[model samples]
Target: MLIGVPAETMAGETRVAVTPETTKKLMAQGHSVRVQSGAGVAASVTDAAYQAAGADMTDAAGALGCDLVLKVRSPSALELTQMKPGAALVGMLNPFDAEGLQRLASARLTAFALEAAPRTTRAQSMDVLSSQANIAGYKAVIMAADRYQKFFPMLMTAAGTVKAARVVILGVGVAGLQAIATAKRLGAVIEASDVRPSVKEQVESLGAKFIDVPYETAEEKEAAEGVGGYARPMPQSWLDRQKLEVAKRVAQADVVISTALIPGRAAPVLITEEMVASMKPGSVIIDMAAGKGAVNADGSVGGNCPLTEADKTVVKHGVTLVGETNLAALVAADASALYARNVLDFLKLVLPKDAAGIEVPLDDDIVAACLMTQGGEIKKT
Candidate 1:
């Protein structure tokens, strides 16, 4: 079996799908690996390094036209044309994009979108979302620290005493939890909020305050419990209450990092225009959910804050909003290494060690959930 690693064509995508470490591993398993020249350049991995690992350095066409192709992002129409029918593709393909899946199906390619993998213990090694989100969360704090004019830690110098920066993190998911931990390490006073009540302990354990909004109704409680390890949409009543609580914190906060996002749904607004207006003049916000949120009339999408512009950092109402969509890509080297390992782990389920051909085990829950387009048809809705 031959595997290809193509350079990511998406703008702002600096991470590659495979690294020299994974290349060697694949070769040891009786598979030949072909990596396009400059595929890992952005990730700081060199062609010489890949060659040393026994990988064939090839052109984009040579890499794309393989029996199995690994990618960081979905292929473009032009790149898709280079692939042969019945070839296998694996990537962080957006499973919710029906048109994209249709395109893969039309190409007669077997596509596996790793983003759709189940959040189970058995699938933890292949969980791309968690791995990427962890990087995003850490970077969010680092970016916030850089943008913030005030010091994160309190200072008592020969002059006067300086207060520690107050940071409020919205959506206590993997990213949010990481943000809290990073902020705490920087000596910032942190507070986090989420619809799921169960994360309060996790928040408190990280030495950050959890903004608790008691569920008033049964529906709110049920929603707060969440589904499948992800937070469900909270009732409007609960949201209103959370808004009021968050607004108070935002007013006093020096930095805000919002990571709230529901899969396949518009990100719920946690910080409103009014909330932004209330914040201090030099306050900074890292909207991790930017480009995945509500689409505005002006053809721009927002994150946890409606004022946030995707992939742009701007000051509106005296608040600096950092709307980077791909924070993990900013940390390219480690992100690529982790993502490549995830791709390798996922391949274990599809590619047998002893066999020369790939096999899709439909009975495997993770494989079944991730299988998007196979056999000239879309397998996942």
Candidate 2:
């Protein structure tokens, strides 16, 4: 099979879909791997390195025209024209975008969006969300600490004693848990909140206090249970109670990291403008779910915090909001390396081990869930 790795064209996106380590693995599996010239440049991988791994270096058109096209972001319209009919594409293509799916269908391309894979033990090895979210979570704390005026760890000086920074993490997903772990290592006092009551143990296990919002009604309890290990949208009553509980923490918090997100939905407004107003001056917030590709009336994508303006760092109510969306892109090398492994794992379902061809197993659950468009039809799993 001919596998192509194209350079990401999205502005400010530095990560590539494939890395040198995975390139050699694919070559050993009897596949011809071709990468666009300078595709891995941003990830600090050079053309020579890919060549050393036995990959042919080519141009954008040449790379996109392969039997299998790999990418970090979804292909743009111009890029679609470069691909051949009936070619297969695999990457983190945004499955939520109806228009993009239509384009892919029109092109008669068999497209796989890895983000749509189910969250099961069997699918864990190929879980792109967890791998990238882990990076986002770790980077969130680092970026928050860098932006804050005070140190994360408490200090004792001859002149005086410096108190440890208080941090509040919202949404206890893979990213939020990692954020807590990262902050704890930095010696910060941590408190976290999540709709699911089950995660309280996870928070306490990490030595952080869990801010619990009790379910007053059966509806709230049922909603909190969520699906596939993801939190469902809570009832307004619970949300109100949560806001009141979170407001108190926000006012006293020196740093805030919001990682809340529901798949296929706009990120819930966890941190409101009022919460930002009450936070301490010089505090920093890293919204990993910022600018989640939602265009606002003002023509800008909003972040988890109401005050956040996407992709920009601004001080609102004396609190700094870091609204960069591509947190995984910041750690490009590891992100690509991990993502490449996931792609390779997923390819095994379609490509046989012995030969240079693909036989996509459409009946497989993981493959079915990820098949956004096949044979010019948007399949519903």
Q: Write the per-residue lDDT of candidate 2 for residues 74-178, one digit (tens) a residue.
A: 899999999999899998888888888898888988999999999999999889999999999999999999999998999999989999999999999999999
Q: What's model 1's lDDT at 204?
A: 99
lDDT by residue for model 1 (1-381), tens = 989999999999999999999999999999999999999999999999999999999999999999999999999999999999999999988998999989999999999999999899999999999999999999999999999998999999999999999999999999999999999999999999999989999999999999999988999999999888898998999888888999999999999999999998999888899899999899999999898889888888898888898899999998899999999999999999999999999999999889877798899999999999988999978
Q: Residue 85 deviation, candidate 2, in Å?
A: 0.6
**Candidate 2 clashing pairs, residues 3+ apart or interchain:** 1-356
**TM-score for each model:** 0.99, 0.97
Candidate 1, which segments miss by more than 4 Å at Cα?
none
Candidate 1 lDDT score relative to the true structure: 0.94
Report how far residue 98 has shifted in candidate 1, in Å.
Answer: 1.1
Query: In terms of lDDT, which candidate is strongest?
Result: 1
